[model samples]
Target chain A: MTTRTVTCEPQNFRRVLSSMCTEPHPLARQAASRFLATNPGDPTTYRTVSKLESEVVERLGEVTGQSDVEGYIASGGTEANIQAVRAARDFHDVNDPNVVVPEHAHFSFHKAADVLDVELRTVPLTERLVADVDAVAAATDRDTVLVAGVAGSTEYGRVDPIPKLADLAAAVDAFTHVDAAWGGFYLPFTEYDWNFADAAVDTLTIDPHKLGQAAVPAGGFLTQSRKIMDTLAVETPYLESTSQATLTGTRSGAGVASAVAVLRELWPDGYREQFETSMSDAEWLADALSNRGFDVVEPTLPLVAASVSERLFERLRKRGWRLSRTANGELRIVCMPHVTRELLESFVETIDELR
Target chain B: MTTRTVTCEPQNFRRVLSSMCTEPHPLARQAASRFLATNPGDPTTYRTVSKLESEVVERLGEVTGQSDVEGYIASGGTEANIQAVRAARDFHDVNDPNVVVPEHAHFSFHKAADVLDVELRTVPLTERLVADVDAVAAATDRDTVLVAGVAGSTEYGRVDPIPKLADLAAAVDAFTHVDAAWGGFYLPFTEYDWNFADAAVDTLTIDPHKLGQAAVPAGGFLTQSRKIMDTLAVETPYLESTSQATLTGTRSGAGVASAVAVLRELWPDGYREQFETSMSDAEWLADALSNRGFDVVEPTLPLVAASVSERLFERLRKRGWRLSRTANGELRIVCMPHVTRELLESFVETIDELR
Candidate 1:
């Protein structure tokens, strides 16, 4: 108590509908605290955390409909996505390698393209905001080494036709990467052909921190085969490990521990309940906005994009509501596990009051 | 009151003489938990933690002998080092960009080179284990984008001739980076010309998680000029922030919060006491090893590398001592903040008994 006060006050989860992350499950928060000082990067020293990371990867594969997969617990989806593109770029040794992705793919792909010196071809989406199959097919050339599909678009949460996208990449002998960061936990209960069992995905990005009820920075990256994962390995000169594949060294074990904690507590069944609740709340909010004469995108996933007036949006923001705007200037509200139906009802009341 | 038990037990700091990181301060551990669920990547939402990150960057600048520097809290030293190299490579705009570094620079430089598609030129070190000024100067050419000098090397705790290294980089019109990941906290108390005030160092990698007693994954990167830091920015499509300069998105505020916690608690006086204790223990270790007829490198910092027999090294491993070997097949003993002199005395007794 005598120590200096932390001026960085944590934001309330109840007020945050903008971010993809939700409040961590109680077990996850406890687990993260216990492993705050461990580093999984040195597997030999932090052997137990390293093993937990292995289990987390296996669980990610199991939920994504693939078993015995190989990967690491990435810092988050961005690092995982970058590694996927990096793996593809290294595997296919083409001059000026190009990567094709849906326009709705996360911005991490752009960071990957710029960092790795690869050409990024962003294909236009269909009317439903899913990846347009024809546009992706037209964009791919012989130099295209990686094709990415978004299972849950950030702005609209549209699930792209990942099966078709994978087939197109197969035609060019390129790697297929699916960015299911926000939808990895939710898509399992839905009948979407977006994961390994439904599509020939080479690599996938799934963040346990986002929708999996884990603490912050718990992202999962998995490969269907070990050979696909080995393309990103850089030989380690130190440590008991022979090679290192992670983007960052001295990686904290908190993410790994917390991810396993939540997965163990609420994998298929618990997540299913959360998904249903989130979807129902999203639908309710969309209907509530539409009834007020605001144009709204269909709630394909638990994310709604509504066309609110700029002044009203500013006023809502001024009301201390944590909100975000989409690329097309629509109000983006992600109904994460914490964004309950009751919370949305009150949010609508506040909007009505301001209007 | 029951849940699935965590299998990953935290490693004891007393036995961990190999890693640069030590136990997190009690205050830092508490602070890390408070901010575990907050995301600093979207600064507008996690305003307080983002503000703490600003304070951390400023504190890092102050400790590194520069005021009003610009940078961010990286995941760890690896990410910070990678970004430093990436910023330089992006800024130079040279075709076939190359990076010049001393032979004993951390393995992160190699990872950065591989990921960023840059040529790595490793110049051999001098007999003293520091970067050979002539060798580094000879390696640098017009195509060299970055020149790196290790302020505290991993193996022998060598402080490279950073001022000379900076001069060589200036001659080649390249950016200079000082890797002070291990030495940053200690060097401030010692007389070393290895920081912003001592040379024309454009970028520096220092970690609060290492010697600063913050939790794991709290590495700091500071740039002498805003221009160098600006080179790494990518435009953000969402959020109130205009651009994202960090390597990873969806960053956790735990590292930022804990870094400030430790920095506030032990900036100069607290760390000065620890540095003295660590150095005394290190010198004690070197003398203890030498007295037992083992060859030892001089402890330039709180790290001692001794050549023990392969059988003894394996025997020590079997006895549950957390140790590491260098590239030269020597036993490395790093006197981190927790590696007390009494612990080293017991280690010596164990070695004598094993013999």
Candidate 2:
């Protein structure tokens, strides 16, 4: 939080593709350490860190194409999504409020629906593994307060037709929410129009920890207007600030500071370079798996979901490769910034030997 | 999370009384850094950090005097409190559910009430600033689903009559929750029985960041039964595990590992000694302020709330004292583990000079 600038050279993560090896940029870690004791929930005391929160929003705005973005650095995408839906539900005129989300939307939506006491209308995806815009439109009515679309889905890395979904939500007077938690950082470099500038999104969920190279728990929640944000505000009687919009209080300043450092260091250029390499790796892995006669999904983004046998998946786990499976039981691999071609080669060689 | 043991010498924070000075033990910080990249939300991938989370629950159960406590390392007290109320509301048979809380319960209860769409009935405290048991008994009805009592309230460090509150809630078939987020670690050293072993508390909110000297966001939420916890579980479809009871989907492993380190290093003896020093500091400050003709609330625990002139409060803020005021405009001071006699002496001297 002091004026002492931390110097951290980026480290090469030449290890396994497990989330554990998804190391942050050194400066981001240093910033987290320096601000370890500060609490951003009470913004008055940690004024500088609080200001850094604004800078984080500013950078996030630049990335998401919202010039006047207003939001906080959240614990992760889950909190961001929860708060977004809470805001939408707070202003609903009907007693039985419902939220319509894509089938591939993050499970955080389900958590939000349960905690907020609202009906969750899950619209199934199309054959392309993206949201069925027509189905989403059909599920909406007067009681629908929110309609959510996924920018980059968890299982298959599929991007929904956000512009069409936004129009459907608008016709029903429902706020549009974009779950770009996994794609917000990478989509900026690519030709994806999933952000605010591309659609009428009222709120967006983006994570700095995903591809922004920040420490964990740096999820960004951006709101289009003050009315949307103030809907979530609660009075704080014991602090200098009268109201707080965040879901949690007394949080570590690690995420806020780390997000600022990562955004400052990697905006546009550094991140663009990383995304290129990661995209190539994902494409390469998809092709390599296809050549080996394995059923693989298209890697539109830097993520691969392939149909691997149960025995082979267990063998990969035994080799210390932490892998995840999709809802349909396909092996899911996210080509994060740390995932390299070298690691994928080793994975392929192991598959051949095991098969 | 690896087998390598970390040794951290406890550092003396003789600098300031601001929350920013509330640093964790050095080893706790080291552990946080080591596990920064891991996500505890997906337990199957980060198996070791997830195991450490169980160990954290074990240590927390010992400290809270509940041999079998079921909970997770929450983002902070805010999440723990919200989840506790959600669990209570989930199983309520009544069409309209209400929660009864003491006057000084943390504002997070209000946040929970707003988010969960439940009625909040706040019972005023007695002249001694503790919960009014009679008023709490009168507040509960057939629609009441939860009764919450505060242990070490925010503005004033006062413990509610948990036994009486629990009894009243049980008579009405409502769950009882204790918000010991600020007092859990210190009350074990004191004579307070605000935990499950002392009362029929269905859920307790405690923070390892507050007195356990862990990293920030290391909040402990303990439940009496697996049935109570299961009420809040939501299906995490994409994760390795099927269901997760936590409110958030992805979280840093920093708080989880740091809590384990702090609990392991200071559980019975180190924290006991620290409590002795902190309690004395609170009492000493109360005496010093009273002798100076300032009206001071009794520092029952290690927190003091005193009446000071508006000009004096502003001057202290100008002097870089990160102070907080109560709802009634009284200055509140929390003698965290970082607060020493010397720092209190400096604060008192500054107050005298400014006056």
Candidate 3:
């Protein structure tokens, strides 16, 4: 077969402020090249890669403060969150089950409700744009199977009061899940109490692709116990293995190997430096935008959202500046590794001129 | 950060006969390296890679005989098949819905039923190990919202009579989906009537990772019309785009780029030659196994299944000859790209010596 002459050179993605994504570490890219033929779907077929995946699960568990964590590498946060919902529903065995999440929760919760036929009770956020424990208390009942807390919400980048939310859900024995897809790796570098060490929390959705510099679509789901994880296991006679407990079959071994490689490269010190740098850059950007008359939300991770006029938003976007807008029309910027101080300064300069 | 010294060299995967998997084409591996930082989730941020993904969808649609097809890159066949079921269930306001599939269908059908709260009615296969169209007709009724046919069954590589199955299901307005994950890329090389050109098939689960020589997890879900695909769309306010119809959010751009690279390398002639060589190899292996007194199932693709005693299966497995087994105890062997003639001949000699 003739290889095409088409060149896929990486474009200048540094100006992409809208996406909460980063480039994969060089080691991860190398690992993906090394394991292109492997598939982790059947552990027996690719034992080496499967072991790497399990190591990733274990290392993520340790970061979340769980000594004995049970989970797998999911496609991404959507599948991880959906799998968490499946685990909660099956473990509880309640009829017509419902889940309680804040209105600011990820849209994947809605997808899960639509797919699983579970009633979704979305509580209104507090004035601070965080999940209100009181509202969650009012929404839960004996039939509530799961209650989710958003750590580092997409728009505002605020960590919900997970400890309080878990306490509220514990009264009814509802499973607690923290969607740390954007916050899990960052929280370890901060003094936040959003981890498995919280006794009431049951599951966590962490994406290595977002902050850990893994290749895309590598979402990690960590649970409190193997029993809870096994609730979603289904038999797969067609595969070399007798059964599987994943959202998809025939998944990529490349994703697993790449994640392991990246995690190993940034185990303790390297990741902290990256997180601190991003946070510092975001703080600077927030200050600059505020000085220019923009009311910016205090970033919990490396995300800064500001109340901007629609005219300004449209003008900036028309100028080829990629920015995400919240439902309330706030301009959102995530300070990933690529989002350097120089890029933000240029963006600020552009904004000042436009204003 | 220090790069890890651990090596990830590709293993001798030719013995992995149980998997319907192949090494990614050289172009695909090169593409993954070129586009390691790109993501297809936010089109505005990764416009070029997103266009590549759409091109993949378009080319796959053309191969499946649908000129105006609408679809996306799914996680794998499971997500593609589940999305097809979701579209069918939502298109028709199905309540207490059931899907009728053949007994040899992939386990993803069972996963969909579990996740969607839909009942699965499995019709038994005929004596020839193919879907019994009459049994499917007898099993489906007013509540049957979808009918799925397996073009390439996992255990026994046999194409079902999809035309007959579709005619039977269309009598009651049930949606028709063909799980061609293993056979879609192969059928264009052979004379098979299991495509949308047949008029009865509505959706196809075609996996590039399985036979198109793309990286793992590159499953394509192509629908006959855009109207049906709209049923699966859900609003994603956080994304640059307004909504998403995919099973995942923040998916890897590597899979999409790799698939397009592989497809471009083997568009019309290159893929046909690969399939022909694999089919001939499969025939040779089947004949050799039969001559050694093992009863072999005639392969429709590059898969061969033979009945082996439990002791023999264990011995072969202990000797590192990877093989899959059917629910009825038939050992399966898939002749992928890496499974060369020399490897098969060595395996046969080993079996002869053991016998």
The candidate maximizing DockQ is: 1
- Candidate 3, after superposition: displacement of residue A341 in Å? 1.2
Ranking by DockQ: 1, 3, 2
Candidate 1, A12-130: lDDT as tens digits:
67688888888899999999999988888998877788889999999998899998788998889999999999999999979989999999888899999988889999999999899
CA error at residue B234 for candidate 2, angstroms: 0.9
Give the winner by TM-score: 2 or 3.
Answer: 3
User: Chain A of candidate 1: what's the TM-score?
Assistant: 0.98
What TM-score does candidate 3 get on C-alpha atoms? Answer: 0.97
Q: What is the TM-score of chain A in candidate 2?
A: 0.95
TM-score of each: 0.99, 0.95, 0.97
DockQ, all models: 0.72, 0.42, 0.69
- Every candidate's TM-score, chain A alone: 0.98, 0.95, 0.96
TM-score, cand. 1: 0.99
lDDT digits (tens) for residues B81-144 of candidate 3? 9998888788777667889999999999999888877889999999988899889999988888
- Residue-level lDDT tens digits of model 1 in B1-355: 3558665464456577777888899989988999888888998877888899999999988899888899998888999999999999999968889999999999999999989999999999889899999988889999999999999899988999888899899998999999999899999888889999999999999999999899877888899788876788887776768789889998878888998988898988999999998898898889989989999999989999999999999888887888888999999988888888888888898899898
Model 1 ranges off by over 4 Å: A1-3, A7-11, B1-3, B7-11
lDDT of each: 0.89, 0.85, 0.84
| Best candidate according to lDDT | 1
Judged by DockQ cut-offs, the docking class of candidate 1 is medium
Report how far off residue A87 is in candidate 3 (Å).
Answer: 1.2
Looking at model 1 chain A, report the run of 10 residues with the lowest lDDT sum.
Answer: A2-11
